[model samples]
Target: MERISKTITAYDKHCDVYNDKFKEFEPYVQKIKEFIELLEPGMKVLDLGCGPGNVSRQLMLSGKEFSIEGIDLSEEMVKLARKNVPSGKFSCRDLRDISFPAESFDAILLSFCIVHLDGTEMADLLKKVAKYLKQERRLYLSFMEGKKDGFEKTSFSEEELFFYYHSLEKVQDILKDNHLSINKLTKQGYLESDGSITTDVFIFASKGN
Candidate 1:
């Protein structure tokens, strides 16, 4: 996992570029708008792996009363996020090692973030999230579709390390075994760093109320 760690560190160095490149994807904006529509006043929402606070920014600016907290593995990304969203909360930490109090949040959003982790890592993090969430709290996750253990050919700078592309069945197994319920699942186009697009998975699960 050394390569993965190194690539993440390198990404932090170019956080601005990461933000700029992703902003071009209209789908990301559309998803956030949909999320904002689901929220109500005084709800506690967490934006996990929140790169530069883009989604959180949209949520806050939507005139909703939800209390938003953002967390990311990269300190540089957190730094940039804090600059624009000084009034909101931001934490620089790994998703797998997060330290939220039990039943603390009403919702948690993991948008295209867990793709960096492998199967074991994802399962471990999901279990931890289960512990921190309320019985009825929602957990939103996004991942790439198709079967991929590693890539043979790619110019995407972030592709140097191990990454797994998971199927819907695999994600369903993870959620089921962890005692979470899939409230909704959507498959849609995800923009790649190279300006190409590919199908991806989006799931919204909830702890049984």
Candidate 2:
């Protein structure tokens, strides 16, 4: 497998404060809950790019029983995930390179992740995800939605990590191509640090034949 991408490695330099900055993001709560409510308890779940494990924490907010494991390119993020959501397992590995048995997970949560990947990477990621997910099993994604795909530099960080935006139509087509059926696609707006409102797309899909 290839080495981690430059943008992901850049995140490690700021891992010390990653949790302090993102652990408070609560917008994913309702969306995650909506997905969980449809499933039975005790299903194993994977939290891909689970920075600080905020999504894992949100999934557990309802006292629901589920097995969770998270992977991130930044080792520091894994460390914080362990501290933030002790009950869930955390690993420092790139999601693109990780392997799992077929149908290993009942559901997968990808919160505020995948925005860094363009169409090709996203397609590859979803195909790998399908291998580990059972037929009809769910996949949740949250990303910065844009009308077109491109890179944007950070406004507050010293490091020049580029954020990639993939259009909603392109993403949905990728999912379909990877044999995943879309269940829901919704958008939520939140105020950025500059007090400007930005919309994020949340998608729930099921693995298909």
TM-score of 1: 0.87
Clashing pairs in 2: none
Each prediction's total of clashing residue pairs, residues at least 3 apart in sequence or on different chains, is 0, 0
| lDDT by residue for model 1 (1-209), tens | 67467656666766786677665457777777776676676788888888888877777778876788998877888998898677679988878787778888888888877777777888888887787778777788888877556642233344354456767787788788877899778888755557777788877788874
Mark the regions of model 2 whose C-alpha exceeds 4 Å error after superposition: 1-6, 147-156
Candidate 2 C-alpha lDDT tens digits along 44-118: 999999987888887666577789999987787788889888899999886667899999999988887687665
Worst 10 residues of 2 by lDDT: 147-156
Question: What TM-score does each of the candidates earn?
Answer: 0.87, 0.86
Residue 185 CA displacement from its true place in model 2, Å: 1.1
Question: Which regions of candidate 1 are displaced past 4 Å?
Answer: 151-162, 191-197
